[model samples]
Target chain A: SQQGEEDPQALSIQEGENATMNCSYKTSINNLQWYRQNSGRGLVHLILIRSNEREKHSGRLRVTLDTSKKSSSLLITASRAADTASYFCATVGFYNQGGKLIFGQGTELSVKP
Target chain B: EPEVTQTPSHQVTQMGQEVILRCVPISNHLYFYWYRQILGQKVEFLVSFYNNEISEKSEIFDDQFSVERPDGSNFTLKIRSTKLEDSAMYFCASSEMGGSSNQPQHFGDGTRLSIL
Candidate 1:
C-alpha cells in the first residue's frame, strides 16, 4: 500500500449501520485528518488526531490512531443517508515544512436509506 | 460562517495563454494554500503561503506557476503559458494557525480550469 492509502475503495451500507474505513501511511506524521467530499464539491474537514493521541470522537464519528502501526480507522456510527460521501485520510508528515496535506485515494461510501 | 470563496468557478483558456485563478480566504486565516486535483486523481498540494511569501511548494509548481497576495484580500494563482495538463480543479484552503499541523483547513469549492 502507498503512503496515505485507504482500504475498501468503495463501501455501501444500510442507513442505520455503522461504516468503518481504514487508512495506512508509511511515514511519521504530526497529525492526520479525515475529510468528506460530495461529488463535484469541496472537501469538508471532519476530524483530526495528533501523533500522540490514540482515540478521538465527535458526534457519531470515532477515529483511532496507532503510531506503532502507522494506521488509523474512522468509524461512523448509525450512519444516515446524508453521510454518504467520499472519505479521505490526509497526513501532515513530521518533516512537512508547509503543513501540506498528503491525501489518500479515498473511500467512496454509500449509505442506502 | 466564514468561508473561503473562489471566483470564476469555471474557466476555459487557450493553450499558451496566461490564466489566473482567484481566492478569498476566510477573514482571519493566517495560512493559505493551493491544491489541485486532476480529473479522477487524488488532490495534490501545490503551494503554501503565509505573510506574503511562499512557505513551501511542490515540484509540480514549476516556473510557469506563481502565487501572489496581490492585494490584502485576494490570493491569486497565475499560470503563465497554460498547458493542456494544467486543466484541473484548483482548490484554495486556509487555516487559522501555521505553527502546528493540527488545525483543520477549510477549502473553497474550487475553480475548474480547462485548457484547449
Candidate 2:
C-alpha cells in the first residue's frame, strides 16, 4: 500500500485561478515536501515544512500541514499556463538512517491560457 | 548552483539484459537516492544511499536492483535483469544534510530507461 495518497487525481483551471492539491499519509513523519514535475522532466523541489511547522510559503506556493489528520496541502495562487504540470507531496517518515521520501500519486494540473 | 546530473539522457534495453544508470550528485552532498516514474505515474522511491551503503529501499527494489557510489563522485543504479515493467524515467537526487529536516533534495534531469 502507498504510504501517501493525494486527493483529486486531476485538476483543470484557467490561468488566473487558484489551484489546491491535498495529500494524506498513514504514518508519522519528520517533514513533508512538495515537488513539481513538468512533462518528461525530473521533480523540482518546491518547499519543505518540518513536522513542527504549521505553514510555509515560497513565492506563489503555499503549503500547510495538519499532523493530527496526517494531511498536507499545496496551494498555487494565480496559476499560469506554465504551471501546467504534475504536483506531488512526499513525506519523510520518522525512521532513522535514511531520508526515504514516500511520494503520493501526483495531481495533474492543466492551466489553460 | 551545484545540481545533480545523469548520463545517457535516454536508454533502451532488451529484456533479461543488464542496464547501468549513472549519476553525479552535488559536489558536497552526502546522501544519494534513486527514483523512477512509469508513464503518467507518480515518482516512486527505489533506494537511498549514504556512507557508501544502502540505508533504505522499497519493496520494489528487489534482488535485481543495486546501487553503488564508485570513485567517490559517481552514483550508479544497476538493474540486473531488465523487464518490460522496468521501463521508466530513472531519477537521481542528492541532499546536503543527511536525513535532516532543514535541507531538501536536489534532483537531476532523469535518464529515460526503456526496457524492450
Candidate 3:
C-alpha cells in the first residue's frame, strides 16, 4: 500500500524556474525522503527530512516536512533541463519495521531550455 | 561514492518460466531491499533483508518470490513462475544501517523484467 500521494501529477517549466511538488501521507512517519528517477531508470536519492525537522536543504533542493498535517513538499530552485525527471516522496512510518518505504505516485517535471 | 549495481539491465521471459534478478550493494552496507514498479505506477516495496534473513515483506511478496544474499557481495531475487502481471522494473537497494537508524537507502539502476 502507498502511504503518500503527490500533488501536481505533472509540471512543466523553463530553465532557471523553480518547481514545487507536494506530498501527503496517511500516518505518522519517522522520516520522509525525496527521490528522482530518470526515464526508464532507477530511483536516485535526493534528500531526507526527519519528522523532528521542519525543513532541510541540499544544493538547489529544499524539503519541508509537517508532521501535524502529514504532508511534505519538495522545491527545486533554478531548474535545468537535466532536472527533467519524475520525483517521488517516500515515507517510513513510525511503527514500520525494517525501514520498508511506502512511495507516492510521483510528480513528473519537465524543464525546457 | 559507491553505488548499488544490478545485472542484465533488461530481461525477457515467458510466462510460467523462472527468472533471477541480481544485485551487488555497496560494500559495508548492512540492510538490503527489493522494490518493483509497473510502468506508470508507483514503486512498491517487496522485501527487506538484514542479518542474512528477511526482516519484512509486503503483501505483494508471495510464495513465488524469494531473496538471497548468495555471497558476500551479491543479492538476488528469484521468481519461481513468472506471471504476466509480474512484469515490471525491479530495483535493489541498501543502506548503511537498519530502518530504526534513519539512514537513506541507495538504489541500483533496476532490471526491466518483461514477462511475455
Best by DockQ: 3
Residue A47 in model 3: lDDT: 96
Q: Arrange candidates by DockQ, highest first: which order? A: 3, 2, 1
Clashing pairs in 2: none
> Mind giving the per-residue lDDT tens digits that candidate 2 earns over A1-110?
43668977999999999999999999988889999999888889999999899999999999999999999999999999999999999988876447888889989999
Model 1 misplaced regions, further than 4 Å: B99-101
Per-model TM-score on C-alpha atoms: 0.97, 0.96, 0.98
Model 2: per-residue Cα lDDT over B75-106, one tens digit each: 99999999999999999999987665457889
Quality class of the docking in candidate 3, CAPRI style: high
Candidate 1, A1-113: lDDT as tens digits: 23667989999999999999999998998899999999888999999999999999999999999999999999999999999999999988887756788889899999999
- The pairs that clash in candidate 3 are none
Clash count, one per candidate: 0, 0, 0
Tell me the DockQ of each model, to 2 decimals: 0.70, 0.71, 0.82
Estimate, for each residue in A76-113, the C-alpha lDDT of model 3 and write its tens digit.
Answer: 99999999999999998887768888999999999999
Q: How does chain B score by TM in each prediction?
A: 0.97, 0.97, 0.99
Evaluated at residue A66, the lDDT of candidate 3 is 89
Q: Each candidate's chain A: what TM-score?
A: 0.96, 0.96, 0.97
User: How is the predicted docking of candidate 1 categorized under the CAPRI scheme?
Assistant: medium
User: Where in model 3 is the C-alpha error above 4 Å?
Assistant: none
